[model samples]
Target: MRARFEKQLLTLHQELIEMGSLCEEIILKTFKAIEKEQLPNTKTIATLSEEIEQMEQDIESRCLKILLRQQPVAKDLRTVSSALKMVYDLKRIGTQAYEVSEIVAQGHIVKSKELHVLQSMVDSVREMVTMSIDAFVHEDEALALKVIAKDEEVDENFDTIKVLLVECFASKSLDIEHAIDLLMVSKYIERIGDHAVNIAKWVLYAITGQLDIDGGE
Candidate 1:
């Protein structure tokens, strides 16, 4: 029974990795669509988000099954419980990516220097999500801590964008509607970064039995 349970845990880990890869693909597509001054493909992003939702449910069920049938103890129990917690963060990341895509579809691209700044933030968050998943898969607490620290850069980017938008408003230089839409997009991206940090924190918990590193950006 223990051997079977160990196999199940490995399987769960692989599924989570696959789900994380899908999310990275979705975000990549969304970002490229915007860079080309094209409306994001909402239908495609939505489809990916739906797939993530299903994966989350499936993984959660698998975790619960192992907990009930195997009654995992000690480190095994922590691993299973951490899997449960991380799924929620992963689901939110997918949802936020979809939300950003939706906003991009609604937005008519604003020609501003601020757009480039926002793109940097988008890139940072993307890296965070990727690294967080990698940390979990490899059980690398140091890498996980690095992911947690990267959130600060995301937060800085968000604040800089907000300040730039406000300056545009004060100078009467940008469309209010376009500025608001971009602001919303940046906010979604920030939230996605927060979720990534949450995932890394759970990874830390799984490995070190510590939960204090989730101090937020």
Candidate 2:
């Protein structure tokens, strides 16, 4: 029974890695679509998001089966439960990426200095998402902590974008519609970072069996 349970856990970890990779792909596609002024087939992004949702459902079912059949306890139970929680965050990240693509499809293209900062946020959050999944698979609390810490950079970028947008408004430079679209894009990216932080916290819980990560709420 223990051997079989261990195999199941490994499968779960691999599935998560696959899901995380998909999320990363969509995120990059969304941002690149805007940056390059060429919206990548919105249909493709939407399909990726749908695939992520289906993956989440499969993972949730697998976790429940493990819980009912194997009756995992202590760290084992935490690991399964954490995977369950992490899927929701991953699903949200995927959906948000799709939404950003929709906004981009509507001709929301931020350029120049603002685009540079947005790209930085995208890079940081994308790293956080990847590292959070790695931390979970390896059960590395230290790496998970690093993922949580990276949220600060994402937040700062959002704030900087907000300030820049405000300046645009004050200077009567950027039109209101364009400025609002840019702000929404920055906000979605910030939320993606938050989801990554949540995944990292769940990773810590799976390892230490304690969900006491600061700023995780």
Candidate 3:
């Protein structure tokens, strides 16, 4: 029975990794859509989002089953509870990617000088998503801490994009409507970064039994 329970936990971890990989897929697709100045194929992004949402439900169900059947105590309970919380972050990341792709469908995410900043932010966010999952997979608190620290870079990148867009607006150098759309994309990417940080925080909680109360761990 113990071995069977352990296998179930292992399967849960693998499913979480698959969900993380899907986030990687859609984020890369969204960035490429921006670079090409074209609408992202909504069908593709939607499929990914649906899969992610389904995984969240499945994982939550499995966690409940493990809790009720195995009655996991101590660290095992912490791990299962943390998985439940982590799925929320992963689901939100998928939702944000869907929003980004929808903006692409709107035909307004045109070529912009500020796109390079947006690309950099997306890259940072992608890294955060990947590394945060790695921290979970490896149970490495130090790696989890690094993922938390990296959120600052993503935040600064978003701020730079905002300032540049404001300057463009003030100088009458950019279309107001398109610039607004671009800001929306930047904001979505920023929120994705926040979700990545949240995942790392949960990973930390799983390992350490607590999150950094002040985000200073």
Candidate 4:
């Protein structure tokens, strides 16, 4: 029985990793599409989104099964619960990537200092998502903490981008339609960083079995 339960836990972990990989692919492709000002293959992105949704359902079902059948003890319970929470974060990241792709497909590009800043911010966010998941899978508290600290950087950059976008629209340097699309792309990347932070928090819970009192301080 113990061996079987361990196998189940390993399966859950593998599924989560697979889901993370899919999300990473979407982010990378979306970034490329945006940088090149070319629309990504919508068919491929849509298929990946569907796959991510299915993975989330599978992970949730397996977690429920583990809870019902094995009745995991304290540490094991935290592991399963953390897996459940992490999947939700992963799904949110996938959604954000899809939003980015949609904005790129709209064929809007703004040439400004703020555009460069926003691009850098998006790059950092993509790295955060990858590192956060790595921390979770490896149970590395140091990496998890790094991901948490990085969230502040994302927020700062987001604020700068938001202000610039507002100025662009207000000053007539950018049409409202283009400004709105760029704003949505920037916001999606920012939200992806937020989801990365959430995943890092779940990693902390999985490792220490205690929720961070200050919400991942």
lDDT of 4 by residue, 1-217 (tens): 9999989988887888889899989888887876675778767887888888889999999999999999998878888998888888888888778767877777766466777877788778878888987887788999999998998888898899889877876785467777787777888888888888888888898889778533421
- Looking at model 3, which ten-residue stretch has the lowest summed lDDT? 208-217
Report RMSD (Å) for each prediction in the order shown: 1.7, 1.6, 2.4, 2.5
Better of 2 and 3 by lDDT: 2
In lDDT terms, which candidate is top? 2
Q: How many collisions per candidate?
A: 0, 0, 0, 0
Q: Candidate 1, after superposition: displacement of residue 197 in Å?
A: 0.4
* Model 2 regions lying over 4 Å from their true place: 213-217
Worst 10 residues of 4 by lDDT: 208-217
Write down the TM-score of every candidate.
Answer: 0.95, 0.96, 0.95, 0.91
- Write down the lDDT that model 3 would get: 0.87
lDDT of 2 by residue, 106-199 (tens): 8856465777899999999999999999999998989999998899999999999898888888985667777888889889999899999999
Per-residue lDDT of candidate 3, residues 1-217 (tens digit)? 8898899989989999999999999898877888886778989998999999999999999999999999998788888898898888899899889988887688876666688889999999999999998898889899889988998998898899889888987895568777888899899998898888888888888888996433321
Error of 2 at 207 (Å): 0.8
Model 3 steric clash pairs: none
Which consecutive 10 residues in model 1 have the weakest lDDT in total?
208-217
